[model samples]
Target: GCFWHHHDCYLFKVPATRTAFWLDKIAKNVARDRRDIGRLAEQGWRVLVVWECALRGRKKLNDDELGERLEEWICGGGPCAQIDTQGIGVLDVTSPPYRM
Candidate 1:
């Protein structure tokens, strides 16, 4: 992404299968991310974060089964295609999130 004054910028999100970012729990809001950004800016750095919902919306447009496909994509299986979740939430065993 383009940065302020034409500097380069990069964005990261809550990573799946990431060991480094695991916290005891995610806050009700993004207080953690905001705090990190403040710390980085204090050190003369720029940090960018892309929210899960934003990427999910874009992924939905490209993949027929954005839900299951997103799991495969996250694991480098391929560009997510689609899977029929049948309206099951995270607890559904058949869901990719539960299986993977």
Candidate 2:
């Protein structure tokens, strides 16, 4: 199943020597969510978190449309530039691959 997240929202395809985190009970699993995000960022992955608030107010939105839009955003398509028909700023991302 496809998620509403863009491929580059985090370190999706990097040589990450790490895993993600959860809100609770991580470590027996991984680590705290904020920690994981910060680690990935420190390791040079451009991360973008889509909080619950961003998912709300989309009554007429179709899931597929959002997924496609996300893909475009992660592909360096420019987000903070254009305003959508709904007058909301698109949050596009661009992360340079980390060098060893």
Best by lDDT: 2
For model 2, give the RMSD to the true fold.
12.6
Taking the tens digit of each residue's C-alpha lDDT, what string does model 1 give over 1-100?
Answer: 1111111112223447643433223331234444555566568653333223323432322344444445544454421122322211221222212211
lDDT of each: 0.32, 0.35
1-100 in candidate 2: lDDT tens per residue?
0012212222223233433432122222222443555566668665544433224444323566556655655776432322222222433333311110
Worst 10 residues of 1 by lDDT: 1-10
RMSD, one per candidate, in order: 16.4, 12.6
**Top candidate (TM-score):** 2
Range of the 10 consecutive residues with the lowest summed lDDT in candidate 2: 1-10
Off by over 4 Å in 1: 1-29, 58-100
TM-score of 1: 0.28
| TM-scores, one per candidate | 0.28, 0.33
